[model samples]
Target chain A: MSAVTAHGVIAPILVPLLTGTLLVLLRGSATPLRRTLSMLGVQLLLGVSLWLLLQVADGEILVYRLGNWAAPHGIVLVADRLAAGMVLLTSVLALFAMMHAIQGSDRRGRQFHVLFQFLLMGLNGAFLTGDLFNLFVFFEILLIASYGLLLHGGGAARSRAGLHYVVINLVGSSLFLFAVGTLYGVLGTLNMADLSQRVAALGPEDIGLVRAAALLLFLVFALKAALAPLHLWLPGAYSAAGPAAVALFAIMTKVGAYSILRVYSLIFGADAGPLAGLVDPWMLVLGLITLVVGTLGALASQRLALLVSHLVVVSAGSILTAFGLGGEAALSAGLYYTFQSTLVVAALFMLTENVARTRGAFGDELRAGPMLPAANLLGGLFLVLALAVAGLPPLSGFIGKVLILKASVGAPAAMPWIMAIVLITGLLTLIALARAGSTLFFKTETHARTASLPNVAKLVPVAALAGISLLFVVFASPIHGYAQAAAAQLVDPGGYLEAVLGAGATDNDADADTDTEPAKMAEVAGPRRTTVHSPPDQIMPAH
Target chain B: MEALIALVIGLLAGCGIYLLLRARTFPVVLGITLLSYAVNLFLFVMGRLSIGVPAIIEPGRSAYADPLPQALVLTAIVIGFGMTAFVVVLALRARADLGNDHVDGREP
Candidate 1:
C-alpha cells in the first residue's frame, strides 16, 4: 500500500495517542485552552474516521503493518468495514460526549481532557488491531483510563462503584491473559489471521485444548458485555458514573460484542473441524436470560440512571441473541441494532443528566417533582429517546428490531423464543420509561422548588445525538446494506487473512510451515499428533 | 514441569477467588494482585518452558525459543502493576470517603 493509505489506517490510533500525550504535557494550562485542544483533536479524529469508513465502504480491507514487519512477525492494524464502521461510531460518540463534558464535568476533575483522549486512543486501538495480544494491551489502556474517568467527580458513590468496576475487570484481565496464553501455547501464533488458518488445520487431539481456550475467552468477553449472570458490575458502574462518562461508556459494551463477533467468526468459524458451533448454544441461552433480567431490572429500577443502564444490558442481550442465531442476515441485523442502541442509549444518558438537573433534590429519582423549566423541550427530547430505546415505530430501533426478527426466521428453533423475549422487553422498557417520564416531568407538586436552568452546551449534544438517531431512520436502507456487507466480510475470513498476510497466504504450504512448530509443542506437552513443515519461504516474507 | 506449573496456577487462582469473595476491600485488592501474578506466570510458560535457548533467531538456527509470549507477558505485567497501584489508591479513597473499607463502601 501507498503511504497515504497506510497513514489512513494508523491515523485513528496515532491521533488520539499523540493528542493525549500532548494534553498531559500541557497540563496546568487554562481550562479553555485544554478544552479547545480536545475539541480540535476529536474533530480531526472524526474526519479521519469518516474518511476511513468511506474508503472501506467498497469492500476493501486495509491492513497497515507497523515498522515494516510483515503480518505474523509485526503488529498490523486492519481497517475493514466492521472496524472502520466501529471507529466512526466511536468518534461520533466521543465528540458529543466531550462536548457534554466540556459544558461542566471537565471542570470537576484534573486532566479530564487528557484522560478522555487516552480513552479514545485505547478504544480506537482496540478496534483496529489485528493481533490478539495487542487487543489485550489496548483493553488495559482503556480500562486504566476508564478507572480515572469513573472516579473523576470524586463522590462516595463513584468511588464505591469504581472499586467494584476495577476489581472485577482486574480479574477479567487476568482471565484474558490466561486465555491468550493457552491459545498461544497450543497454536504457536498470536496473529489473528494466522490463528484462524492454524485453527482450521489443527489435529483431532488439539481441538480439546483450543476449545477450552475459546470458551475461556468467551467468558471474559461475556463479563465485559454484561451478559446475564456475569452482568453484576455494569449497573453499579454505569449508574454511578458522571453523565458524560456514562454516555461515552455506551460504546464500551459494543467493544465486547465486537470482540466476540470477531474472534468467534474468525477463529472458530465454520471451517474449524470441531469448534464450529461451540459458543452459539451457550450465547443463545444466556442471551435470553439477559434480556429477561434486563427488562425486569428496568421495570424495578427506582432511578432513571439505573434504568438506562439496564437498557444497555438489554441491548447487549438483543445483539448476542442475534449473533447466536448464526446467519448472514441475522448478523447483519445485529450490527444494525448495535449501532442504533449505542446512539440512543448514549443520548438517553445525556438526557438523564439534564432532566436530573431540573428536578433539584428529587435528582432522577422516580418520585414527584416540580415543573421542570423548559419542560416541553426537555420532555419532548426524553420522549423521543425513550421511544427509540423502547424500539417503537418511526425510529431506527423499530427498524433494527424488525431486521433482527426477519433474519432470525431462518433459525426455527430460536425464532419464537427470541421474538417473544424481545417484544416483552420492549413493552417493559416502554412502561418503565413512560412512568419515569411522567413522574419527572408531568407530575407537579405545589411545595416543590424549581431548579436551575439546564446548560445550552450540555443540552446541545443530547439533541445532536437524538437527531442523528432519527437520521438513521430516514436512511435505514443504505445503512442496513452496509451492515449486510460488513456481516458478509465477517463470515468469510479469507479476504481479511489475505489482506493481512500476502495474497497466497491461504495455501496449504503456509499452513504446513506453521503447523510443525505447534505440532512439536504439542508432542512435548501432551499425547498429540504432529505435522511436518515444508519450508519457511511459504510462511514469512523476506526483507 | 507442566504439572508443577498447573498446580501453582490452580493454587494462586483458588486463593485469589477466596479473597475476591471477601467482604473487605484490602483482601480483594490483594486477591487481584495474586491472580495477576498467576496470570503473568501462566503467560510466560505458554512458550513451553524451554531452557538455555536464545530468544533471538540466527540465520542457521532452527531451535530458538519463542519470544512473543515473553513480550506479551511483559506487557501484561506492566499493566497489572499499574492496575494494582490505581486500585490501591482507589481503595484508600473509598475508605476515606465512605468511612468504611467494606468492598461495597459501606458498613455491612
Candidate 2:
C-alpha cells in the first residue's frame, strides 16, 4: 500500500472532527447553507469509510500511528476489516439520518448539525482507536454528543429520560476508568496489541487481578451495549429522543457489542493463558437474558417508539449471543446482524415519527388514531420494516438470524437455549409489530380525518433505509463473505500485533531486535542521551 | 500513605454509590461527581504513589513516577468535569420542565 493509503485510518476520525469544528464555527450562517455543509461533510465521510472498507476487505490490518509515534508508546489507529466495516455502517446510517434531519427536526435544537457531526466523529474514533485510554475518550465523546441529541427537543419526557441516560453513563464511565487503571497497573501498557502480548506472558501471581480488570471492562461495555440488567436506561432514553436523533442512535448500542468482540477476542482470547474464555459464559447468559427481557418489553410496550427501542435491545442481545458462541462463523454472523439491525431500526424510528405526525393529536400511542391521508404508502413501508425487524422470511433480518442459528448448532451446550430464545423472540416480535401495525393503520377513528398528507421528503429517508435493508437480503452472500473475512482477522491477533507494535513484537526475539534500541542508541550517543531519546533511526515509519 | 489513599478511594466510592441510589436527581448528580473523583484518585494511584518524584524524564535520574497514569487521570478529570457540568444542567432543566426533582420526574 502507498503512504497515502496508509493514512486512510486517521481520515475517519479527522474528517468528522474537522467538519464538526467547522460547523460549530459557522453556527451563525444561514440554515440552508449550514445544512448543505453538513450533508456534504457526511457524504465525504461515507465515501472515505467505504474506501477504507475496500482497503481492508481482503483481511489486511492497517495501523496508522498518530504523530508517527510507535505503538505501546504513542497512540495508534488499527483498521482491520471489522473496524473499517463498522465505520462504513455508521457513515451509511449518518447519511440517511442527516437526510431525515434536514427535512425539519434539525431546527429543534441549538447546534443540531454540530452535535450530529461530533457524534459521528466520536463513533468513528471509538471504532478506529487501538489504545484503551483513547477508547474511553471516544466513549465519552459519543456519550456527550448523544446526551445533547437526546435532549434536542427539550420536553418533560425527554428531560426525564435524559437525566437517567446521563447519570447511568457517568457511572459507566467511572467503572471504565477503574478497569483501565487496574489494567495499566498490572500490564503497564494501554495499547491493545501490546496488552495482548503482555496478557499472554503474564506472571501467575498477577493473573487474578488482570482477570478482574478484564471482566470489569466487560461490564462497562455491557452497560453500553444495554445487556439485560444494564439495559434499563435504553428504552426510556431512545423512545424520548427526537426522531432524527433516535434514528442515528441505533448504531450507538452496537458500539458496545463491537468493543466486546474486539477486546475479548484480541486481549483475552485463547492466547491469554489462564484468563482465556473468562467472559464467554457470562456473555452467553447475559445475552440470552437481554434477549428475553427485550422481547417481553417489546410485547408490553404501549407506544411505537418504545417498542422499537426494545427491538434495539433484542438486536444487541442477538449480536452478543452470536459473539459469545466463539468461532469465526458465529462472529461473522453477529457482524452481519449488526449491519442489518442498525439499518432496520433506524428506518423504523423514522417511520414511527411519520406515523405519529400523520395521526395529529393521537400521536404514536397504541390506541386508535384518525385516518391518515397517506395510509397505504405508510402502511406498506411499516409492513416491510416490521417484517424485517421481526426477522421474518424474505428479509435481511431472517438471513442474519439464520446465519447465527447455523453457527450456534456447533455448540451443543448452548445450542438449545440459543435456538429456543432466538426463535421465540422472533415470534413475539412478529406479534407485537402486527398488533402495532393494525392499531396504527386499520383501527383509525372515523370522526377525525388528517387532511395534510405526510411529507414525501421525510418519507424519502425512510424508504431509502428500507430499500437498503431489502438489498442486504439480496446481497447477503457478498456481505457475509466480507464479515467472514473480518471475523478471521479478529480470531488471529498476531497480524494485529505486528501491524501495531512493528514486526517481531510478539516473538521472543522482539526484545533483542527493537526493545533494546533506545538503550543502545542512548549509550552510543553518550552524554547527549537526554536529547537522543527518539532519534530518526528509532522512529518506526507509519505502515 | 498507600493505605490512606486506598481508604480515601473506598470511602468516596462507597458514599458515591449510596448517593447514586437515591431517588432524586440532585443527589444522583452529586453521587456521580463523587464517584468520578474516586475514580480519578484510583487512576492516579495506579502509577504507584510517590512523593516529590518527577513525572518527566531527565538525565541522571534512574527513578521516576509513571507519567502515563497521570496523563490518564488528567484526561479523566477533564471529562468527568464536563459530564458533571452537563448533568447538573440537565437536572436543573428536568426540574424546570417536569415540575419535579425526582429522577423519574414524578414520585414513585
Candidate 3:
C-alpha cells in the first residue's frame, strides 16, 4: 500500500515503453549505442520485474489505478504473484533475446532494438492490465510488433509465414473485439473485478449468452496458445521467425495460457453460478488432441526449427491439459511447467540457430554435414536443451511433468487421459529430438570446407538459458511453493477482487441489478432518449 | 434495428470467412479487412446505438448511450487500419519476392 510499491507496479511497463520510444528516436544513432541502450533497458526491466515479484510473492495483489481513476471507470493494472512472475520470466527471456540479437541478428534489419523493446512493452502490459479492453489494445500492440519482427530477416519463407500469422491474428483480434463487446453489452462493465462480481450474480436466463461470450473469448486465447484445430498457424510462424525473434516469441503462447487462466478463474471460477466449469471439458479434450498432433508434427518435422516449433505446441497442450484438470495443485504444476517450457524452448531456438550456423550448407535441416567447429560445446548445449524440452530425468521438465501427473491424480477421469497423452508425447518428443541430435551432430561427415564456430555472444545466451533451467531443477522446492501459492490465489480470487474493487463490495449488492434485460432495449428506448442519472460512489482513487 | 445490425455483422463475418479461405493472398487480406469492419461495427453497437445522446456525459443525464464501446471501437479502428496497411505491404512484398500471391507462397 506504500506509494513506491504502488508506483513499482507500473515500472515494468514504463521502462520498456520509454526505452523503445527512445530507441526509435535514436534510430539514426550507431548500432552500438542502440545495443547498449536496449541492454540497459532489458536489464532494468528484469530488475523491476524481480522487485515486483518479490513484493507480490507473499500473496499480495497490487492494483495501480491510472490517472487517479477508480477501479471500474478507469484503467487499472493488477500485479499479483502470477502477473509479477510472468513479468519476471518475460524480462529474463527478453534479456537473453536482446543479447542474442545484439550479437548478429540486429544487423539484418532496421530498428531491431526498438521493435524488441516494444515487444517487451506489449508483453508486460498484457500481463499487467486489469481491464479487458486494455488487454485487447495490448494484444494488438504485441501482434503488430511481432509482425515487424517476423519479417525482419526479409525472406520468402518469413514473408509467407508472416502473412498467415498477420491475417490469422487480425481475424483473432476482430474476434477479440466482438467478444469484448458482447461481454460489455451483457455485463455493463470491463473491469475484471467488476465482471467477476457481476457474472456471479447473473440469472439463469443470461447464462447462455455469457457462456457464448466466454467461449468466444476462449477461442481467441486458444488460437494464440496454438491449441489443436486452431494450431495450424503456429509451426509456420514460429519456424519462420529468426532465431532471436523466435526466442522471444516463445513467451507469446504463454500470454494465451495466462489469459485463459486469469479470465477463467476470475469470471467463471468454481463460484460462477451457472457457467462454472464451462471450459473444463473442452480444454481437456482439445488439449489432449493438441498434444497428439504436436507430437506427431515434431516427429514428422525434418527441420530443427519446425521441430522446436512443434515442441512449443506440445508445451501448450501440456499446460492446457494441466489447466483443464482444475485444482490448485494441477494449476500450480501447470504454471511451473509453463515457466520451464518457455525458458527451455527459448534456449532451444537459439541453440538450433547456432547448430544450423555451424553446419555449412545443411542450415539446421537435420542433415549430416561437415564436422562443426566447437562441436563439443554446441552439442553439449543442444543435448541439455533437448533433454530438458523432452522431459527427461534430472532436468526441470521431468520434475514439472511429475508434478502435473501427481496433481492429475485427483481428477480420476482426466488422470488416465492426461497421463497417457503426456507420457506418450514425452516419449515421442524424446525420439524426435534424439533423432535430430544424432543426424545434425553425431552423424557428421567431413567435407573440404569446415563449418565455423558459433560466436561467443550467441552461445552465451543459450548457455545462460540452459543453465537457468538447471538452476530451476536445483531450486525446485521454493519455486514449487511459489507456484502452489499462486495457484491457491487463482482458485480463490477474493484477494484479487477485494484489492481491485475494495473491501465490502459483495455479490449480494450486485445481484440487486441483475434482472436480465432484452437486447432490444436500445431500440425500445430509441436513440434520442435521455434521462437523469447519478453515478455510483467513487470508492477508490486512481492515484 | 438490433436484428438488422446483427444481420449485417453476420453477413460481413460470413463474407470475411469466405474470403479468408481463398487460396490467394489478396482475397485473404480483403477478407481480414471485411472481418475487421464487421467487428468494429459490432463493438460500436455494444453501446446500444443511441443517436441523439451526447457523446460526453452531462451533469444530469442518466439515459445516454454507453460511450465506452465508442472508445473501444475507435481504438479497434486505428489498430485495424495500421494492421491492414502492414498486411498489404507484406502481401505486396511476398508477391514480388515469391512471384506469386498464394497464401502458401507457391503454386499448386
Candidate 2 chain A TM-score vs. reference chain A: 0.94
Task: Assign candidate 1 its CAPRI class.
Answer: medium
Q: Give candidate 2 misplaced runs (Cα > 4 Å).
A: A449-451, A509-536, A539-543
lDDT score for candidate 2 against the true structure: 0.89
lDDT of 3 by residue, A1-543 (tens): 778997999999899999999998998998899999999999999999999999999888999989867777788999999999999999999999988998888989888888888899999999999999999989988889999998998988998898889888988998888888888877778888878877777767778878899999999999999999999999999998999999999999999999999999988898787888789898889889999999999999999999999999999999999998888999999999999999999999998888888776789897778887787898899899988998988999999999999998998878888888899899999999999988987786765368887787789999999999998899999999999999999999988988887766554454324333343444222212111111344433111
Q: What local lDDT score does residue A486 receive in model 2, on the 0 to 100 scale?
A: 88
DockQ order of candidates, top first: 1, 3, 2
All models: lDDT? 0.87, 0.89, 0.87
Q: Tens digits of per-residue lDDT for model 1 on A1-543?
A: 567887899999889898899899999788898899999999999999999999999999999878766677678899999999999999999999998998888889888888898899899999999999999989988888898988888899999899999998998989888899888888877789878878877777778889999999999999988998998899999999888888889989889989999999988888776788679899888988998999999999999999999999999999998888877998999999999899899999998988888787889898888888889889899999998989999988999899988987898888899889889888988999999998888888878887778777788998998898899999999999999999999988889988887777767655554554445542233212222222344334221
State the lDDT at A190 in candidate 2: 86
- Per-residue lDDT of A191 in model 3: 86
How do all the candidates rank in terms of lDDT, highest first? 2, 3, 1
The Cα error of candidate 1 at residue A63, in Å, is: 0.4
Writing each residue's lDDT as its tens digit, candidate 2 over A1-543 gives 898798888998888888899999998999999999999999999999999988988777898888877566789899999999999999999999999999999998789999999999999999999999999999999999999999997889999899989888999999999999998877767889877877777766778888889989999999999998999999999999998899989999999999999999999988877888889999988999999999999999999999999999999999999999989999999999999999999999999999888888888899987878889999999999999988998989999999999999999999999999999999999999999999989996778766357989999999999999889989999999999988988888888987887766667544422432222332221111122123456554311
Name the top DockQ candidate.
1
Per-chain TM-score, chain A, candidate 1: 0.95
Highest-scoring model, lDDT: 2
